[model samples]
Target: DAGITQSPRYKITETGRQVTLMCHQTWSHSYMFWYRQDLGHGLRLIYYSAAADITDKGEVPDGYVVSRSKTENFPLTLESATRSQTSVYFCASGAGSLTDTQYFGPGTRLTVL
Candidate 1:
């Protein structure tokens, strides 16, 4: 098991609904990232934060939002959930550029019907 884990491993919501996926890591890292895996899109970065209170949008951040308040906690929110946004979401944390390794959480499978 990883030190990092995502809450509500599985979730089902209706279109236009709002959903939030929680992520927590035991190993405190300066950087945390959120990614979504889709059929054709593969895995795309949604958001990332370099440190507490410093976050930036990633490849796909139009329909989603993320916040990093503390070093070990990062949460992602879907402002207006949609069917097309259905995908497996992953949360990861990494040390500085030295390790070049990211510990990933299990992943949250969300279905928007």
Candidate 2:
């Protein structure tokens, strides 16, 4: 598991419930990111953490939360998920440097009904 992996590759749930998608990377990269992709819209960053306890909100952080207390795991939680939140989630990681390239995990497709 030297690369990143996402759990529950597919999910379907009703609105107003909370759902958490797990992300794990064995590379021990210092930077982790969460993003959501929707039809007609490219990936939008939800949150990112440079290191343990160093997290920041990205462009679309509303309704979503992330934590990175460990270097190899970053989980994204949708608090009170809504129909509007249905989208494909992706997890990515990179070294803690600007010159590093990010590696993406297989996406998780979530549908809210």
* CA lDDT scores, all candidates in order: 0.90, 0.91
lDDT of 2: 0.91
Assess candidate 1 and give its TM-score to the true structure. 0.93
Clashing residue pairs in candidate 2 are: none
| Candidate with the greatest lDDT versus the true structure | 2
In candidate 1 the C-alpha lDDT for residue 102 amounts to 82
Worst 10 residues of 1 by lDDT: 95-104
RMSD of each: 1.8, 1.2
Top TM-score hit? 2
Q: What is the overall TM-score of model 2 with all chains considered together? A: 0.95
- lDDT tens readout by residue for model 2, 59-99: 89999988887889899999999999999999999986734
In candidate 1, stretches whose alpha carbon ends up further than 4 angstroms from where it belongs are none
TM-score of each: 0.93, 0.95
Error of 1 at 88 (Å): 0.2
